[model samples]
Target: MQMLIIGGSGEMGQWFATFFKNEGYDVWISGRRGRSDVAEKLGVRFTSTPEEIIPECDVVIVSVPIDITPEIIRQTAPIMKPGSLLMDLTSIKKNPVDAMIGSAPEGVELLGTHPMFGPSIPSLQGQTFILTPVENRCEKWFPIMRELLERHGAHIEIITPQEHDHIVSIVQGLTHFAYITIGATLKELDFDVQGSRRFMSPVYEIMLDFVGRILGQNPWLYAQIQMQNPEIPNVHRSFIEQCERLSKLVVENNADNFCTVMKDASVHFGDTGAALHRSDKLINAKVAEFEELLQSIGKEKGLYHIYSGKTHVGIVEKVMARSVDILESGKLVNLKIENVRLLNSDELNAWKNDNLAAKTRDISTYIPENADPDTLCHILGKISEGISCKVHDTYISPDGRRSATFRIDIRQDIDINKIQDDIERLLEGIGCILR
Candidate 1:
């Protein structure tokens, strides 16, 4: 059968077009802009004139914005063939379903559907498709639609239009309200969310991620879902009432009442233990995924501060099959990748500067003398003023000659040979030879 989707430039509409095309139907999409490139990518036909295409299509799905869907249904419903099917993809079903029933031709089938996902989802596996069949004059069309969705692993929930709206009010309305409120509160408080992450527990991090996810989507879509559903106001009122009751308990400092409230909620939810178990598995999976990302960062060639049970700073010289080779304080150290709890670039630049300073002081000289420690310290002190230097202990040779050694540390950007020559000239004047 030929299928046409209005507003097919939209993400959800494009999804439907592609899905129906994959099911061996001749799929075409009509939009205001006539996005031929999008139609080509989705392997469907594109048309700027939908009125010309509506009457020819066996299945017409109105997939426009929620607010515009009713009008689109009214315009196209009368033009559809007598035995053809009509449907809409609207989050709130009652209004669009009513419009289709009132406007569609006498014999055209009407089905209102809401696919509970976005376009980024790869397939319909384990996803839900809520169907509210308003009129099924073509009785076989409903079964065909159900079979097509089921073949692709979609779980179909057939309900009345009123029932769908009522359930979504709680499911989408209450949940999104809580998320949006939390996001706004954080913004109002000017919370330093990234700076305070060091103090966040896993649960807090997950909740923050969820808030981010919600705010990242198109605002109009969320607004439509919250505003278009007639049942949302009651849901919001109930949510606020519960919050007020919790606040009163806190104000009264009534621990017993709070416990009773918690018990009642737990009972209402039911299967608490199973829910906890499932959530624990999800949390563990997230933690493992985070660790794997850290391990991948550790395998990169750069300076990293590794923290397993202890902290060590080094440059990641090489990544081996079973371990990593790090150059730490002029020595190569190997560490197993799995043993690292955190490997970060926080102290990398500081460690690199220190390493460069150490490399500049690579030359060490010893001078043979029989001088007192005080005199040697004084001579070294004078030379130290010109450059960075540290004096070593004196050692007596077999010939009873005493020798002292010192090292010079300089900046990497300076002329190392010129500084060494200048220091040697001063040392020779003090009767100390470079050994």
Candidate 2:
């Protein structure tokens, strides 16, 4: 299958390019700018002239900014071949869906997809994917695409384009507006953000993180999200009106009215208990990680970097609120606690096996006449990631029993004696005698 992403130079587009590539598709990327370097990094072909490439592709995905999605779809959809699929990876749906349906040829399939996630998400697993398929336009390929996404662990919701945009007005519009407003308030008040963290509670800390997260992203994309959605202005108005009411209640010190407002809002919100439980779990997880770091002082621990996917094994020298100092290879490396995860023993061994070279040791042993050395070696290999086994040599023993030398390959930076002991126990259980 050949998949072409129209805006593949962008982060989200590059993400999908890699995604389709992993799914065994030949991915081609097209960008308005000279971003062949982006394609080179993703190991996919880049086309400066998407017009020539559009007709030949089996699937064409438009992944540009939301404001320009409809424009891109109009320009690209006409050149699409009959029976091919046209999709957009944007947050908003109605405008793009309308553009695609109107511009695409009679047989070209149209699907409006809103991947309810950011480019920072590694994979589709546990992520939400919104699909808005035209009534008669997607009968042929919709089921296959839906099943494919679901099989890869995505939660799919089938909705009309109108419904998707309507719901997203609250989901993205209100949430982002609230967080961005908090940031604006801080700036206007000249609040000391870093200094305040010293006296912050867990809820405040987590809320601050949410605010920073949105503030750190592409402002243009956020601007498009806030501006392009037709329903968002209404959301903004209601949000402001409530904010003013709350402010008035606070300034006037009307305790009874404030309580009444809060209580009414809580009732309307529904299911406060579940929200509390989930929040508590999040807070507890953070506390637990902090406790682990404190206890790991002076002990060797493996920390896995989130973005780089690299593991650093070292003795913990000191732990701070947001970072840790590790004594690795006689040098102190400071890693942000938020950017890394603590790797357990098994995870550390697995990382070692994948990232490090293996050291081989030959184990010569004798077994029963009916024993198969190849099977035994495979079993030994399965016992742990620290070691893998292969039959090196085979011969007949003095008592007519089978004899074999197993080549045990050990992952670097692991305990050799421990692996040897584990292999010994398995060999003994299978009735093999050491030479």
Candidate 3:
């Protein structure tokens, strides 16, 4: 099967290229610059324009930013062959999907998709891909698309174009705006991350990591996420109003009123049940801190609930020596931990069953392929600026295969080629094979 990736040099585009290439498909990437950077890196063919590549492909997956999605669909529609599928990966669907419906030629299939994760996760092991099929003929391509995604481990969800955008107005649109605003606020405050690390709590560290993460994503992409959807501004308005309510409660020093508001919001946000409470390490540290500060303290264990997913995985009625509030029996335990990064489903389950004390890898020893000691350290410094994976160790085997493991918890939907090519290129520079 031939797959053509419009905007093929983009991060997501590169991800799809690597994915199809790995699956032994004929993958060709086309982009505006006419440059084939991603295809070259993945050792796939590349084209400067869709006109040169579109007719030859069975599937055309457009991975351009949301703002340009409509124009891209218009450009691509006239050129797509009949019976061929044309789909886009834009986050907001209504406009682009509508554009595709209006622009696509007769007998051609049109669909819209949102993979629901960044290129950070390549495997799609547990990620969801939302699909909105435009017409009846589009049904022919749905199973083909689903099969390819499922082969790479993505969960599929089908929704209409309108429903897709309205829901994402909250999930993608609101969330992106909030994170960007927080990142900007931090910059304005001139918050020194280095100094803060000296007194880091798990929660605080996680929040800092989140700020850095959203900040590192493409500025233009984030801007598109903020502006492309018309419903986002209203969501943003509601969020700000809620913030005002919280601030008013704090300023008035009405603890009871604040608590009531929290209860009401909690009831509205139905408990997902899979939330983490405190890691065992965190709880112990908190207890120790309280003991040091107070002369007298209770000696009763706190309630903890372990979660595998939406369902309750395990629960700890007590930890043997610290008094704590027991909320619902099957209620979420870690509902208050902000900026908490997620683990893959399997790792999460393992850690939860083990009571969250699982050993984490230390990244200091990791070396990059053929990188000078100084360069390796610099690369690690750059990587440390973000919240995701970190390199663990780099080694070249006797047979010439070079590899570097990482200390990161991998997400199912992350595009590994983004990093894999870096490693491969580095190894090739050092005259090593991938084996």
| Best-matching candidate per lDDT | 2
- Candidate 3, residues 34-114, lDDT tens digits: the string is 776657778999877668788778888889888888998898888888999888888889999888888888988988899
**Cα-based lDDT at residue 325, candidate 3:** 24
Clashing pairs in 2: none
Shift of residue 299 alpha carbon in model 2, Å: 2.3
TM-score of 2: 0.93
Sorted by TM-score, highest first, which candidate order results? Answer: 2, 1, 3
Model 2 Cα lDDT, one tens digit per residue, 131-190: 999889999889989998999899999999999988999999999999999999999999
Alpha-carbon shift of residue 338 in model 3 (angstroms): 18
Off by over 4 Å in 3: 272-274, 277-435
Number of the top-ranking candidate, with TM-score as the measure: 2
Segments in model 1 whose C-alpha atoms lie over 4 Å from true places: 135-138, 292-435
- lDDT digits (tens) for residues 128-242 of candidate 1: 9999986445486889899989999999999999999999998888999999999998999999977766687778777887898799898999999998998999999999999
Clashing residue pair totals per candidate (backbone < 3 A): 0, 0, 14
Model 1's TM-score against the true structure? 0.67
For model 1 the local lDDT of residue 333 reads 76
Cα deviation of 208, candidate 3, in Å: 1.8
lDDT of 3: 0.69
